[model samples]
Target chain A: MSRATILSAILSNQPQTTQLPEDLQFDCPAKAAVTEKFIQMINLIGGRVVEIQRIEDINLYATAHYGAGERLITPIEELDFYTQFAGDEDPHQFENIAFAVFKTHFAVAENGAVWITEDRMGARVLPFICQHLGMLVFEDSIVSNMHEAYQLIGSQDYGFGTFIAGPSKTADIEQSLVLGAHGARSIIIFLLKKEL
Target chain B: MSSIKHPELSDIFNKDEERVNWHDDTLWWIRAKRDKAAHGISEWELLRETASQIKNNVLSNLHNYLIEFEEKAQKNGIKVHWAANAEEHNKIVLSLLQGKGINQMVKSKSMLTEECHLNEYLESNGIDVIDSDLGERIVQLAKEPPSHIVLPCIHKKKEEIGQLFHEHLGTEAGISDPQVLTETARIHLRKTFLTRRSALTGVNFAVAETGEFVVCTNEGNADMGAHLADIHIACMGIEKLIPKKKHLSVFLRLLTRSATGQPITTYSSHFKKPRKGQEMHIVLVDNGRSVQLGREDFRNSLKCIRCGACMNTCPVYRRSGGHSYHNAIAGPIGAILAPNLDMKEYADLPFASTLCGSCTNVCPVKIDIHDQLYKWRQVIVKEGYTSSAKTVAMKVMDFTLSSPTRFKLAGKIGRWTLKHAPFTVNNRLNLWFKNREMPEAPEESFSEWYKRNNSI
Candidate 1:
């Protein structure tokens, strides 16, 4: 079998094994200002952040920011203005969604990315097919760097998960940045101060 | 029956001086962005070292990790396939598509697939593959291969791209705006993403601990295609496997910053298992990687994460363009890796470099790219893959330099020729004079002047 042949080949040619580094810990002096750094990074990456005192404020924020003509879909029950989408549907059905407001497990401060899984998204394509994406992340759930983020997500089970830092963009044409190549054009993160 | 080498191909690329300058400046700008992003983190060097050590551990015990990954992925309800070569990989994909009765598929940027020539193989088998990445799609429309790994169409100007879109995508002529052209591609590819039953992506890193793989993209086209499709197929080289999921932190931190100077790619999507009612398949392809692993000097080349940092920092790559390397993966990394696959075919690639060591310094995993380039040149020459002229030239150089008298005589003759008949050394016939002017010859040699002036 090719598997056996390939495996044997690799094993035969193996170099002396070196034990993995003992300490994976990295100390970042900027940990105290993770939130401030997170916001700065988000702005630089073309993502917007709105601080809300309560999760219920998302409804008013959605209406005030997106207006009535926009089609809103969310898994969060607190946002009454947005329609709660069914978990089961053809991915293509959500192609024209104007806004997708979903809850992220946690947010990484170093890169301004929120971790979301397929279960939270209802449909896998909801986050990408939508014209805009709005993520609800608790302020306390933010980690300082990717290392902390991974530590928090140790051995977690999920079919699909992603660390979405910003909206879809490209610089393919003469290296000029263009937003909304094939995914959401704009991503707005709503930071909820209260616990879920 | 014709085989052209790197020099001949680069000559063609250098025909347009303006394009060459634009390509060089654009890549250098990206390199500068990488510098800024790398500088943002205080422990960037520490992070690179940690990542390099982690890769070393993985490489030493790769067979174990691959097995563990395959076992865990299979247990997670994700199908795992192993291919000895590109042909087997392509056949596995074809059978999967055929079983599902799918005629077309959408593929994100996968240099592995490109190396396998999967698109052409599938097309020959009557399967239509649509490239979804904006840069990749631009090259696909132009009916050409990607020049750079990260920026596939970096060799193309906006006007040329506009013309390509105008001809292939039916956009208005003379429309060179990136926004309009990108939007046109977005609308055009959305239909393909929605309709295609299967999506193929290149795996950036596969974790053995959690049985998951990650695909990073700035445009989010990989997510759009994979999430929307019913089946997702990820192909990776055997060297892409990491020991654990936590290793991702170091690799991801270093990946985008080194590639395009971004803090991180826009989307770093992880696939642990198949989505509900959908199928996910991971193919581990050897395709001469095992042979590369057996070679000690070149095994470090497998540590590359396909970030294209070396290509951006490469002076030759920037000036001659990525296509000049004439391989699926080009630039400094490609030059070393290509010769391992085919010595005779890519013998010229190793010599294409100037050994400035910039590529090695910029490498995220510290591949020792320039050192490997030097080694490959020796290997190629030893294997008799070099041209006869170069071999003869080396022999004459050795005969003259090995003897003191012959060296002194040769130096005298060379200086005399340069001083007396300057035109003999400063003409088109002289390869060195092609792009440079001959230096002035002094009346006396430095050694001669030193001997005459010394009283002791």
Candidate 2:
């Protein structure tokens, strides 16, 4: 009844149908330096980028920066040092995970964000609840802007997806930037060097 | 009982002159950041224009789009609920929680819930709702409402927040660093996110084409709460809808750049359907929005994305503080939107601005905010909601300005009072004389000078 009443009220009140605008692609501001701009933005937003030639390098990077006692989990099979994700645990079970390395569908250059879905995340909370996060982004997969990112993701179905640009942060206290507020404190982008 | 209006409330906020200056400078710093971020994109202006047109079209055919969104979202296995008003919205949420036998809940930053007074309502109803956003949690601990939409406790100093954390969150005293405060909150709320069965988040933009809604946040608290909860409740005003998913390209580019000068929020999470065995409920809340849609002059206010750019760019909001507006939203956008809900209660809000058009300039969707503000003044006055003194003042001005002889006489009297009886015009009763010095009274009127010069 509420739905019917609300719709009737809206129908009686809303203006006549107006046409949607034609889609137009805007040029990227940083035209040729997509990778450079990606790194710059990633650093500016308090995220780190570590260039790697192969997926095996992530294990070395992880082992050097992290220790064996910590729970370093990943969905990427190439990273042998990190434990493989089971993908079917209670979201609460992953709360103690110190590090999570997952693969992103692609990366957006302008904003330095990686597009990921629940499938890549292993669990919905894996990307958010971990103390530190590492998202693997292929160099060629870096699109210039949001338009390209959306074009790539046109009608692709996923239950949950996100564009993670940086680590969790807030500026609530007098505009001072504070990191690790109820989510991942640090996000390191593993930029894979591949042509395609 | 009648509450304090905008002028008096702002006067209270302005009493601490140093704090007022700090607030002004802080918000201006954010506005500057926004300018820098907007300048980074070559297509920034074009992007804003495209986003505005999309919103215009969405407003024009909102009913159909809402239906489309609901149908698609339901097909995606999300339960859709409709509420005609705030009370109904709250009730639906309560019933959902009750149905699950969940006593504790977690909510992210939702101004709609703030407008509905959901926290207190739920508290009295025995449902403990914890706000998981860092800023929101700070204000929640202080027993205060959020000051700004995006930055909830911008009015609070670090020392004050540290004190609040000390008292409520069991932090060490005098811990004023933002890093420590934020970490303490993360530890405190991590348990809440893990334990709470119901999670409610604000909807940033809901795509009718894909039946998925986006929640943008820098802290990622919304995802933490929703991903872990059994029942994910998203509260959305009907105006948050866009026609298609691709339109997000234009808006996502503009949203955070306008708010805090970021390329985008750290996490722009899209929730389309619930995870296996989890319940997802989207409440399409009217809550005076349909009435706002019918108002031609004020309908564009509904197009706001709650980025708080207008607030950051608002001179009145910066100097007077966001709490002064006494609405769920504060600042220029709030001034125009509040009166539509209760004109009599918010009659003074439209008059809070200087009609500087700065809010309109920075608005990502170009809502004609200053113009709508000016229009609301006329509507409020016509509805007899303005103060009686202002009404009388308008009547006298009308009588004097409508005729030449009367205008001339009134000018003569005004000049005489200013020149001879200066106290009559330079006192507390005249609001114009408060922060400004009245100009020196001339010996003769401009018309008098012209008549004598006669050479023209």
DockQ of predictions, in order shown: 0.82, 0.85
- Residue-wise C-alpha lDDT for candidate 2, range A128-193, written one tens digit per residue: 999999999988788888999999999999999999999999988878888888789999999988
For every model shown, the clashing-pair count is 0, 0
* lDDT tens digits, residue span B1-456, model 1: 113477788889999999899999999999999999999888899888888889999889998999999999998899999899999999999999999999899999999999999999999999999999999998998899999999999999999999999999999999999999999999999988988989999999999987899999988899998988888999999999999888899998999999999889999999998877789999999999889988999999989999999999999999999888989999999999998888888889999999999999989998899999999989988988888878988999999999988988888888899889999989987889978889877777777889889957
Candidate 2 deviation (Cα RMSD):
1.6
User: Model 2 compared with the native: what TM-score?
Assistant: 0.98
How many clashes (backbone atoms < 3 Å, residues ≥3 apart in a chain or on different chains) does model 1 have?
0
Candidate 1 C-alpha lDDT tens digits along A66-139: 76777788877777855555655778888778888999999888888899988798788889999998999887
Q: iRMSD (Å) of candidate 2?
A: 0.9
TM-score of chain B of each: 0.98, 0.98
Which lDDT value does model 1 have at B266?
93
Model 2 residue pairs with clashes: none
